[model samples]
Target: MQNVLQYLPQLLGAAFKYTIPIAVISFVIGIVIALITALIRISNKRGVMLVVKAIFRFYVWIFRTTPLLVQLFIVYFGLPYLKIAGIAPDGIKLVPFTAGILTFSLNTGAYCSETIRAAIIAIPKGQWEAASTLGMTRRQALQRIILPQALRTSVPPLANSFISLVKDTSLAASITIIELFEVSQQIAAANFQPLLMYSLVALIYAVFCTVLTFIQGYLEKITSRYTIA
Candidate 1:
């Protein structure tokens, strides 16, 4: 018990150092990518849009199907090999922190795009028609009427995604990011108390997820206030 307490501050500090930054940066960029992909997937254009949609579908498929650890390995270990093929510069290096953020963002973006797309689709056709009748352009209608409602509906799913991303950030340790879980492993290695160390790590993650859940509930209430239901 004393040993566990002794390591608590260091583990928690390392979590704040690496885990939170990776999750926040990745999730923010992921939201941007998801919004863009969702919009592109819904476009009505024929040739260009078809090609774009196909590309994004392939991207989402690849990320969703592969293990994230493999993805991280590819980014961290494989990318630098491009120099050997005369593609990238010889000096190119993929830092663990940068690679971790990039991998997590791409993975989260692929999954969240579908959630956002479905939310956008769920908005009634009547709302678009109503906006059109009011002399609104397609962009205007989407910006004013459809998107707000879609965002409201999207809150729950996106919140879940963010929570999942927080947990997934631990996987960054596989590539030497030295996050919360990695810190636990280090402590356990020295003390020979894997069970106790891991239990503390799990408890910290549960606390983070629980806080996110409360925030999710609060946001749901705020978004629901103006909703008809």
Candidate 2:
């Protein structure tokens, strides 16, 4: 207990340093991949749409069905076994940070793809007709008219996903990345005060998620003005 209290600052600082990058990078890359996936899902070409849907569906099925911890293990541990023989070289394996970023990004992308696809589909047919009447091509209408509205519609869900990613970052610790929960675990193990350390970690996560909730509400209010519904 005394040791945990004494080292609180160091523990917290290390945790935040390790966790923030995972959350931010994952969210950004995930959103971009999701947007592209959504665009493909909504395209007029049947072949393109089918391919995109299959990719997204498979991604979502795999990630959602498997435990995230196992996924991280495969990325950090299993990949080395399948590396390109001696060409890949030793010590060039995925680092904890790389594993955190890659796994989180892929996991978030699976969910975000669905949210984005729904948003794009929800765009009003009249909006498309209006854009075409103005001499816009389908691609131009999607880019100029449909996507913006879909983005607004997607905001709340995207915010929720960001919040979830922020908390899930603790899973990175399982791969030896010293994220919040991992730091707390170390503190508790050293001091024999697991309850106190874990409680603090939980509190920190709750506060962060709470802030995200407020931001989501504010964005929803601002975007509501532009919403077709």
Candidate 3:
């Protein structure tokens, strides 16, 4: 009991210092990546654009299918062996934080792109036609009419993604990130009380996720206020 209390502050500190920042930054960047990917997937462009779309499609497929831990290892550990004669003789290595952020963002972005794509597709064709009749281009329609509605629909799923991302940051620990989970592991090792320490960290994660869910519900209400009824 004393050991748990003694280490509680250290765990919370790690959560604030590493876990929160990693998840928040990754999710924000992931949303940007997702939006761009979704838009590209839905575009009708050809020629060079078709090649671009193909690349993004492959990116989404590969990331979604692979395990994130393996992805992390590849980025952080394996990349260092990818030697280039001129540019990177010792391979392309990144710091632990950068690697973790990149992996998490790409992984989440791949999944979230599908969520965003479906939301955009759910908007009716009539809405696009109406925008076109109003002297709006496809870009204008997306920005002014279609995207707003799609955003409303996407909020719940995207919010869920953010919540999931918060939990997934724990995996960053395996890459040597000193996040909440890693801190707990350290404490458990010191005290030789793995179960209690693990449970405490789990509780902290639950609290973090629970708070995000409430925020998600609030955002849903905010986005739905101007309903089409």
Best by TM-score: 3
State which candidate has the highest lDDT: 3
Q: Candidate 1: where are CA atoms >4 Å away?
A: 84-87
TM-score of each: 0.95, 0.89, 0.97
Q: Candidate 1's residue-wise lDDT over 57-129, tens digit each?
A: 8988999999999999999988876665455667357899999999999999999999999999999999999
In candidate 2, what are the lDDT values of residues 127-162, reduced to their tens digit? 999999999999999889988888888998899899
Candidate 2 runs further than 4 Å off: 1-5, 46-53, 85-92, 227-229
Please list the residue runs of candidate 3 whose C-alpha ends up more than 4 Å from where it truly belongs after superposition: none
Colliding residue pairs in candidate 2:
none
- Angstrom error at residue 70, model 3: 0.4
Ranking by TM-score: 3, 1, 2
